[model samples]
Target: MARIFTVDEARSLMPAVLRHADDFVAVRADLAELTHDLRHEGESPLGGLAEAKGLEARMDETLSWFDDQGIEIKGVAPLLVDFPALMEGVAVRLCWLEGETALGWYHRADLGFPGRRPLP
Candidate 1:
């Protein structure tokens, strides 16, 4: 079932989301640092590139975290994207967990794009 959130209910999840985002940001930063070092250190650091899937798994953890909290990622359609400030191909959206209001917003996945929208 879809977890439609009221504005307030959705806002409550911000702390959790922010915390998870912080974790993700940290991992991403570490990866970036490693990538930089690889430029001087050579391709040896690129070994176990598959293990870097940890980052993707962590992201899924965030989504699953939301699912456990009762929120659902709206499918890639029927989006409530009515905004003047939206960048090309995306408009701010309201997403939430079950029995909650819209908690925050996310852009469709684009590799390494940091753009995100907190509940308005």
Candidate 2:
């Protein structure tokens, strides 16, 4: 079952969440760069493949941590996460993106990122 968090509960876990997120972002970026580099080079596929495999493993580990925490990763490029929350007894996602100092947005579970609204 998905974990439901209160506003305070989610904010309290921010430190750990952000730390895990940082690792996830770094590994993901490394994997992306490796992919791009491999695409441009025709001579050595094995070397890039090995590096990509390692990075992919690291990314998987990081993602697993998020899954274990019941936090939803909405995107990777910009690093967005959603904490399931209930507002006025209605289900909503507490939206957070990298570079933001605090959780400042939310959206109904049915709506995706585009429907994000500011937290009241």
Candidate 3:
């Protein structure tokens, strides 16, 4: 069974989530640049294959951290995390996108991001 988070519980986790999100974004960008360098220039001053592998490992670890917390990872480029919860007995996801400052939105389990609405 998945862990269900209450609004306050989800909100309390924001600090750690934000930190992980920042780490993910930075590592992703570095990996992209290294990939581009290797593709176009045939080598990257960024340590080539070794550095790229390290970045990949770091990214995986960050993602695993979220998964271990029972938070769902919906997107990577613009990091999106969803907390499973029940609202008035209806299954829903408490949605938090990359740029949002707080976890203040949710969507029905079947609706996804397009159906996101403010948490009442």
Provide backbone clash counts, one per model: 10, 0, 0
lDDT of model 1 at residue 45? 57
Q: Quote the lDDT for 116 in model 1.
A: 49
lDDT by residue for model 2 over 1-120, one digit each (tens)?
Answer: 899998888888889888888888788877777787788874344357878899889888887787788889888788889999999988999999987878888999988788899999
RMSD of each: 10.0, 2.4, 0.7
Q: Specify the highest-TM-score model's number.
A: 3
Worst-scoring 10-residue span by lDDT in model 2:
41-50
lDDT of 3 by residue, 32-112 (tens): 999999999998888789899999999999999999999999999899999999999999999999988889999999999
Q: Report the candidate with higher TM-score, 2 versus 3.
A: 3
* Residue 105 miss distance in model 2 (angstroms): 1.1
Cand. 2 Cα-lDDT:
0.85
Please report, in order, the local distance difference test score of every candidate based on alpha carbons: 0.47, 0.85, 0.95
Poorest 10 consecutive residues of model 1 by lDDT?
A: 76-85
Which prediction has the highest lDDT against the true structure?
Answer: 3
Which clashing pairs does model 2 show?
none
